[model samples]
Target chain A: MKVYAIYILNKAGGLIYQNDINPGLNKLSANDYLVLAGTIHGVHAIASKLKPTEFEPSSKPFGGEKEIPIESSATFSSSISVRDSTINNDVVNGRWNNPNTNNTGLRSIETDLFNVYVFQSLTGIKFILITSPNPIVHNVASLNLKINKGELNRQFDLAKEIFHNIYVTYSDYVMKDPFYSLEMPIKNNLFDSKIRELAK
Target chain B: MIYSFSIFDRHCNCIYNRRYIHDGPLLTQSKPSSVNLKNSIGDPLGVSITSLPPDNGSGDNFSPLGITTKSKESGSSSAINGPIPGYINKYNDSNASKLLFGIMYSLKNITAKLGDLASLFNTLKSFSTENFRVHFMESATGLKFVLATDNEVDNLQHILKELYTNYYLNHVVYNALSPVEFGTDANEHGKISNSDFINATDSFLTSLSVFK
Candidate 1:
C-alpha cells in the first residue's frame, strides 16, 4: 500500500501533474519527467495493441478450484450463504479472467526497489502509480498461504483504487477550474494538499 | 440505494446507462397524496400524478430560471415512465437517465469556471444531500461517469473508476465492434454489448454496502 510517486499525463502525453509522495527515489529533471511521461504513454499504447501469444495452462483449472473448497469450506458456509459462494466463484473465475490476459497494457513492472503501475483512462490520460515492491509478501507469508496470481491480482485491484481516487481528485480540482488550461501543468495548492491527504 | 448509473462522452451524449432497482428504502421522501377523492366538479378520477414528489428538495436551487422542469419534462416524456408513482422521484417522469446526464454535464461546466481557483476546482466527483448521493468521475478527455447512491456508500469513486477501467475502456473503447465514435452507433445508440463487462459490473455493484 506504499505508493512511491504518482505521474499524471494528458492525452498528448504531456506531464500535467507529478508528485513524489514518499521521498528517496532519485529525482528527474523537469525535461526528464516530460520524457518519462511520453515514453510510458507510447509504450503503453504499443503494449495494449500487442497481440497476445497464447500459452497452454500448465495446470488444470479444476485442480486449483478443488483445493479452495476443502481449505475454506468451513468458513465459507458460516458466512452470508448467498454472497459466500459468489465471492468464492469470483476468486475461482478470476483465475482465468485475468484482465491483463493480453499482457498489452502496462500493468506493473517490479524491481527490488519499487513497482510501477500504469492506469490508462478511457480518453488516453495515463496515471502512473509507483509503489514499494512486495508490499504484501510478508503479510501473505505470515498468513501461511502460498503467494500466487490471486495475491498479485488483489494488489493490482488495490492500486486501481488508488489510481481511481487520484483520477477523481484530478478531474475535480483541475479540470473544472476555468483558469486551468488543458494539458497545462497543475499548480493549485488545494490539489497538492488533496494529493498529500490521499497519500497519507 | 443507487437507482441508476450513466456515462456521458465529452459531447454530452449518454454512452452507457443502467438502472438498478432495490427493494430497500427509497432515497426520496414521497409525500402523502390526496388520491381517489370523489370529483364533485364532474371531472373523471383520471390520475393527475399530483405532488410529483419533490426533486429531493433544495437540490434544484441552482435552477433559478425554472428551466429544468420545462426542459426535463419535454425530454423525459418519451424515455421514462414514473417509477410506481408513489415514491418521491429525484428525476422527472420522462427519461431519468437523460436528466441525470444533463445535470452532470451542466454542473461540470459551471464548476470549471473558477479561474486560478479553477485549477483548484477539479471535476465534480460526487454531490450528496439529504438521503441521496450522486457519484461522478470525469476523465481528462471529459468522459463522465455518473452513479446515484444512498448517502451511506463510501469509496464509490473507486467503483466508478473500476467501471471506467474494467467496463467502459475494455468493452467500448477497446472493442473494435464498438468504436469510440460518438453520435451514432452501428449496433445501437447508447447501448453497450460486452457481456463480460456487464456481468462483472453487476456482481461488483450488487456486492456493495449500499445494496445491502
Candidate 2:
C-alpha cells in the first residue's frame, strides 16, 4: 500500500506533473517518464475500445420481467454484505450516488511487485498512482485462496480517497494560481508541499 | 465469466487463442436493458463490427473530445453491444490479440525494471479495466497464459498452473507428433492446432465455478 510515484497527465495526454513519493521504484529519465505517460494514455484509450461486447439474450416474452428483480436483488445483497463488513457507509453511498462519474477506462494494473492505478477526472485529466501491491492481494497470491472482495474494495476505496484528496489539492493550488497556464507543468511550492503531506 | 484465453510463446507470438461467446443470464444482467434493446433491433453486433472505424494508428493522439464524440456516435448508432464471447478457433491474428500481447510485453518489462533488481520473477500478474480483468501467468519456459474475465473474478494463477502442469504438459509438450516450439515462419505464427488439447482446455475451463 506504499505509493511509489504519481503522474498527472493533462487532457491532451501530456505529462504535466511527475513526482517520486517513495524510493522503491527505480527512477526513470525525464524523457522516459514522458514516454511512459504517453504510453499509459494510449493504452487507456485503446482499452476502452477493447471492451468486450455484453451478451445479448435471445428474444423472450417473459424474460425481461423475471430477470429484473433477481438482478436487482443480487446487487442489493452484495451492497448490503459490503456495508455490513465495513463502517464506511458514506463512501459506499457516495460511490453509488454518482455511478456515471466512475472512470470507464483502464483502472488498475497489478504485478508481482507493484500495482498501478489510473484515476481519470471528469475533464479527462489522469491521475496515475504507482504503489506496492495490496497486502490482501499479496496474501492471496501466496496462499492460493479466493480473494476477499471486501478487502479489495477497501483498497480501492482508500485509493479513491487519495485521488479525491489529490484532486481537491490540485484544484485549490494549481487551478487558482493566476500565473499558472492551463495544461502546463505545475510548479507551485504550496501544491508540492500538499502532495508531500498527502504522501506522508 | 471468462471472455477469452490466449497463450503466447517466448517469442511473443500468440500460439493459441480462444474467445468464448457468453450469452448466459449472468452476463446479460450487467446491462440488461441496453443489451435487450440492441439485440431486438436486428443484430447490432454485426452492424457494429461492420461500422467500426479502421485502425489508423492515431491512438497516441487520444483527447477527451475525440473519445466522447466517438462514444456518443456509437451509442446513438447502435446500443453498444460488445463482441460475442466464445471459444472460437479462428481470428487469432486479430488486432486485439496483437495489442493485448504488446500491452503485456511492455507492462511486464516496465514492472520488472521498476522493482527490486535482485528478484528474478518480477512479472505482471493481472490488470483490470472497467470492462474486464486480465489474469496472467508465465511459466519458467516463457509460455504466457492470459485469461480475460469479468471484473468479479479473482486471481487465476493456480488454475493457470494446473493447465500448464496437467493439461499442457500431457497434451502438447509430451505428444510425439506435436511441434516442440510453435512457429518459425511469419505466416503460420506457430498456432497449436491439436484438437485433443483444445477440447481438454475447453472442458477444464468450463468446469470452473467462475465459468458459470
Candidate 3:
C-alpha cells in the first residue's frame, strides 16, 4: 500500500521515527510519538482478534475470513518459507523472492487525520513513515480486491509498488549510510529527492 | 661445476663419488632421485617439496621460499624493482606468480607426486643487507633479479653484503639436508651439501622436499 505515514517501534516498543508528509495531520511531541506508536501497536493487535470475522466459503478452501481481509490481515501461502521474521506481509505478498511468511503485523493505519506505515528491519530496528492521505484516495483498491472484484485492481498494485520503491530507497540511502545512526531522522539528499518525487 | 647434464639413463655408482655440497641432506647416495627415476619415463605434473635454509637477511642471493627476516620489512606492489612504488593497483606479474603458488597448494599433489627435485642439492646462499638493492640469479630461467629498498641499516654486516667480499656474507648454505629428515649422520656439518640442492630440485615432484 502507498504508505501515508510511517512509525518505527524499537523491539522494546519505543517509537523510533514518526513523520507527517501531508499537511493535514497534527504533529506530536517526540515523546508522545513514541507512546502513540507503542500503544497503537498493542491496541491494533488486540482489536484484530476482536474484529468480526466472516465464515469460510464452501467453494474456496483458503477464503475462510470475512468478505474482505482487514488491512492488516496477512496470509501465508503454504508454498514459501520466510527465515526472516522481520519483513511485513505487505512486503512479502508483494515482492520478496524468498518464501512467504505466515505472520504479517500492523504495517500502517489510515485514519482521517493521517496514514502510518511501519517497517521493521532484521536487526529489530523499526522505521515509521507518516504521510497525509491523498484526499482523493476514496476508492483505491488493494491487492485482494483484484480477486474479489475481478475488476483488475491496478490502483492497489500501483500503491504497493510505490511503497516498495520507497522502502528500497530508504534502505539504500538511510540504512546503509555509515553517518546515519539508528532510529534517527534521515536527511540524505537522495532520500529527500526521491521522497519528493514519490510525494508528487 | 654447475653445468647442466641429462640425468636420464645414468648408472648408479658408474662415476667416482666425491664430497658434494648436498650429500648430507638427500636420501639417496650417488643415485638418481627415487621420484625422478620413476618419472624419467614421463610424468607431466610431477612436483615435490624440498627444505630450504633459513633466511640470512640478504635479498639477492636468496630463494623464493625464504620468509622475511626479523627486520619485518613489509613488501609492496610494483615496488619489486625499485625503491619507488609504481602504481600497479591491479595484480600483475608478481601477484600472478603468488596466485599460481596458491593454486599449487590445492592441485599439484593429485596431478603428479615425485620424490626429490634434484639428484644433488645446494643449500640456498644468502647475504644480509639494509640497502635498497639485492642481487639474484634465477635457477628456472637463469635470469638476474635485483631490487632497491628504502629501509636503512647502519651496522652493515655480511649477510646482506656483496658476494665478492670474502667477509661480506655472515653465513653460507650447504644443501637441502636437515638432521631430522636424513638422520644424525646427515648433520655432520652445519652447512648443506651440493648433492642436496640437486636432489631437492631434481624431480618434477619438487615440492615434496622440506625445501619447498
Give each candidate's interface RMSD in Å. 24.7, 10.6, 39.6
Provide TM-scores for the models.
0.36, 0.73, 0.31
Model 1 C-alpha lDDT versus the unseen true structure:
0.51
| Stretches > 4 Å off in candidate 1 | A1-200, B25-94, B115-121, B185-189
User: Worst 10-residue stretch by lDDT in candidate 3 chain A?
Assistant: A143-152
lDDT of candidate 2 over A104-174, digit per residue (tens)? 35788887677888888656789998888876565565335354443444666677778888888888999
Candidate 2 residue-pair clash tally = 10
TM-score (chain A) of candidate 1?
0.68
Chain A TM-score per model, please list them: 0.68, 0.74, 0.52
**Candidate 1 at residue A84, lDDT?**
48
Lowest lDDT 10-residue stretch of candidate 1 chain B: B58-67
Which regions of candidate 3 fall more than 4 Å away from where they truly are?
A1-5, A44-102, A117-156, A181-190, B1-212
Error of 1 at A99 (Å): 53
Write the number of the candidate with greater DockQ, choosing between 1 and 3: 1
Clashes of each: 16, 10, 75
lDDT per residue (tens digit) for residues B42-129 in model 2: 2322222111222311111111111111222222213312233233434456556766777777777667767765764836778777
Best of the two (1, 3) by lDDT: 1
DockQ scores of the candidates: 0.01, 0.23, 0.01
TM-score of chain A of 2: 0.74
Q: RMSD in angstroms, candidate 1?
A: 21.4
lDDT of 2 at B61: 19
Q: Give the better candidate number (1 or 2) by TM-score.
A: 2
